[model samples]
Target: MIDKIKRIVEPVVQDFNAELVGVTLKGAKRNYILIVFVDRIGGVTIEDCTKISRQLSKEQELDDLLGNNYRLEVSSPGMDRPLKTPQDFKRNVGRFLEIEFEDKAGLHKLK
Candidate 1:
C-alpha cells in the first residue's frame, strides 16, 4: 500500500521541484494514516496539500489500488519529520522542532 502511494506521489513532488522526504503509515484496522513528507521551504500551504491529496486520491480511485477499508491523509511533514541525517538538520536549521531520538533519550533544541 505504501509503495503504491509512493509511486503515485513521487512524480508529483518532482514535478513541483520538491523531493519526497518520507512516507509513513500508522494505525491498525480500518482507520489508517498516510503521512507524506516533502522537502518544502516555507511549509506547504493547504492548497498544496489539497492538490496533492486530490491527485493521489484520483490515482488511487482510478486504479482501485488500496483495495481495502482505509482512510487517506496527505500533508507535509511539518516539524515532526526529524533530522535523521545531517543534511536534514542543515536544511531545517533555525526552525522550531520536537525531536525524540531512539538512541539517545533527550530533547534538545537545534539551531
Candidate 2:
C-alpha cells in the first residue's frame, strides 16, 4: 500500500527538488490517515508541504488511489527523525544519536 503511494508521490516530490522521506498509512477504513514525510538539503518549509499536499491530493483523487475517505498530511521529518536507511545515518554523521534496536538490546547513544 505504502509502496504504491510512494511510487505515485516520489516523482512529484523530486519535481520540486525534495526527497520523499517516508509515507505512513494509519487508522480505520473511513478514517484513514496518509502521512507523507518530505525533506530537502536545507529544510522543508510549510509552503513546500502545502504545495506537495495540494498536488498529490489532486493526483490521488484523480487516480482513485484511496477510493475512500482519507486525511492526507504532508510534513517534514522533525528533529528526532528515524534513520531508516544508511544514507540517513551518513547524513547525520557527527551528530548525537539515540538509537533503539528491535532485539531489545536497550537504547544506545552515539556521538
Candidate 3:
C-alpha cells in the first residue's frame, strides 16, 4: 500500500525539487490518514508542503488510489524521525544515534 502511494506521489514531490522522505497510513478502516513526509537540501517549508499536498490530492483524486474517506497530510519529518535509508543516515552524519540489531548482539550506541 505504502509502496504504491510512494510510486504515485514521488514524482510530484520531485517536481518540486524535494525528496520524498516517507509515507505512512494510519487510523481506522473508513478514517484512514495518509501522511507524507518530504525534505529538501535546504529543508521544507509550509508553502512547499501545501503545494505538494494540493498536487498530490489532485493526482490521488484522479486515480482514486486511496479510496474515498482518507485524509491526506503532507509535512516534514520531525526532529526524532526514524532513519529508514542509507541516505537518511548520510544526511544525519555527525549526529548521535542508537542502533539496535536483532541478531542478539545487544544495543549499539554511537555518536
Can you give the TM-score per candidate against the true fold? 0.63, 0.75, 0.73
Candidate 3 per-residue C-alpha lDDT over 1-111 given as tens digits, one digit per residue, 9 for 90 to 100: 778888898999999999999899998667789999998756789999999999988884424766777888999997677788887877667766666555568666554
Q: Lowest summed-lDDT stretch of 10 residues in model 2? A: 60-69
- Candidate 3 residue runs with Cα over 4 Å from true position: 61-63, 89-111
Which of the two, 1 or 3, has more lDDT?
Answer: 3
Quantify all predictions' global Cα lDDT against the true fold.
Answer: 0.67, 0.81, 0.83
Worst 10 residues of 3 by lDDT: 102-111
Which regions of candidate 1 fall more than 4 Å away from where they truly are? 27-32, 60-63, 93-111
* Model 1 / residue 9 / CA error / Å: 1.7
Query: Which parts of model 2 have CA positions greater than 4 angstroms off?
Result: 61-63, 89-111
Judged by lDDT against the true structure, how good is candidate 2? 0.81
Candidate 1's residue-wise lDDT over 13-105, tens digit each? Answer: 776656677888787655566677776655667777777766666665424644466566766766555467775776676777665434366
Which has the higher lDDT value, candidate number 2 or candidate number 3? 3
Considering every candidate listed, which one attains the maximal lDDT? 3
TM-score of 2: 0.75
